[model samples]
Target: MLHVTTYYDTLKVTRDAPAIVIQAACRALMQLNHPDNFEGREYEAVKIAEDLREAFDVLIDPNTRAQYDNWLAKQMEQSN
Candidate 1:
């Protein structure tokens, strides 16, 4: 089976990770993938940064995070 990456994976956090940790991980990853830092690969860096930002937005909100968790749980169960 192919491995799929989720929002938590994007942020490098666990299922129950705290918002602070999520924020920090997103910040750290964004820093590494920042367009200015990648120069010639700015487009690729921006794409990655955008994904990271989307993950951060979803994971940082309690309501959306809860919805996402439910969805993730279902996905895992089905995968097994």
Candidate 2:
């Protein structure tokens, strides 16, 4: 499984950021990286857009977010 930190970074947010912040970050990332944002790099743009959607999906769901948060805390504990 991908680390929660990895997911948070995918959405460009801090681990402790609130759900609303996560949602806002996801929206910002989508708007910035959306396929339409890259007029020339269509292929790369599509890939970015897909990644954005996946990140948003995982972070936006409460259950998944809780799981991610738990995993993240565990990782941090292990790291220290």
Candidate 3:
């Protein structure tokens, strides 16, 4: 599963970042990781692109983002 922590890092945004920030991050990352940009590195690029898409998929949806934020909080709590 794609972790919320990964998404935050990929987007270079804090956990409390707004929806617009998430969307902008996804757009920027997708531009760099898009299949067409990979060329010979299709396999690796595809995987990265998929991860970016999954992150956007969750973060773009308010409910899913909320759930992920909660999950991330719990994960941090346990780690601490």
Candidate 4:
């Protein structure tokens, strides 16, 4: 299986980071990678922004976030 980092990694936040912090990180990343903010790199920027949005969505949902956390723990345990 391909190893993928957790949503927290995608947002560059700690696993225990609060929702407000995660929201701030998401907003900041979106602004930085917004398609309009890039000139010739609009396509790449848009893709990154989309990924950040997806990560934000998962992390913002309590149930999904908990599930993701559990999965991440298992992955880490297996890796070790």
Candidate 5:
């Protein structure tokens, strides 16, 4: 089966990870996926980097994170 990546997975952090940890993870991922760091795959790298940035924005905000957490829980419940 193909594994789906969630925002938490994208950042390499746990769902309950604190904002600081999430920020650090985002930075690390951004650096790794930076377009300039890749050659022929620059476009794909840029897209992944942008996604990391977006995940960071949503997960760093308390209100949005809470909402996202709820949605994630619902998804997991449905999958079971």
Candidate 6:
């Protein structure tokens, strides 16, 4: 089985996490992966930060989040 990465996983939050929890998770992840914190791996850190930002963008909005949630549910069902 292929393990697909979801926005919830990117933010390190549960699928049913609240908006505030998602927000906090995104902030914490970005801070942890900040380019300034990794001198040698700065490029890797930037890429990770970009992914986190994308996850945050989708999960932060109500309409998009609902759409994503539906899509994620189908993905899970297929994976099973």
lDDT comparison, 3 vs 5, better candidate: 5
Span of ten consecutive residues with least summed lDDT in model 4: 1-10
Instruction: Give one digit per residue, the lDDT tens place, for model 2 in 1-80.
Output: 44443787888887678879988988888788777778888899788778877877878888998887798778878877
Off by over 4 Å in 4: 1-4
TM-score of every candidate = 0.91, 0.71, 0.81, 0.87, 0.89, 0.89
Candidate 1 similarity to native, TM-score: 0.91
Q: What are the lDDT scores of the predictions, listed in order? A: 0.91, 0.80, 0.81, 0.89, 0.88, 0.92
Candidate 6 lDDT, tens digit per residue, 1-80?
Answer: 89889998999999889999999999998888888899998899989989999999999999999999899889889889
Q: Pick the candidate with the highest lDDT.
A: 6
Question: Which candidate comes out best when scored by TM-score?
Answer: 1
lDDT of 3 by residue, 1-80 (tens): 34444677866777788989888888888788787987898898888878888888888899998898898778878877
What lDDT score goes with residue 10 in model 3?
Answer: 67
Model 3: residues with Cα > 4 Å off, grouped in runs: 1-5
After superposition, the stretches of candidate 1 with alpha carbons farther than 4 Å from their true spots are: none
Candidate 1's error at 74, in angstroms?
A: 0.9
* Candidates in order: C-alpha RMSD to true structure: 1.1, 3.7, 3.6, 2.2, 1.6, 1.3
Model 5: per-residue Cα lDDT over 1-80, one tens digit each: 33678999888899889999998999888888887888899889988988898899999999999999899888888787
lDDT of 1 at 49: 87
- Per candidate, the number of residue pairs that clash is 0, 0, 0, 0, 0, 0
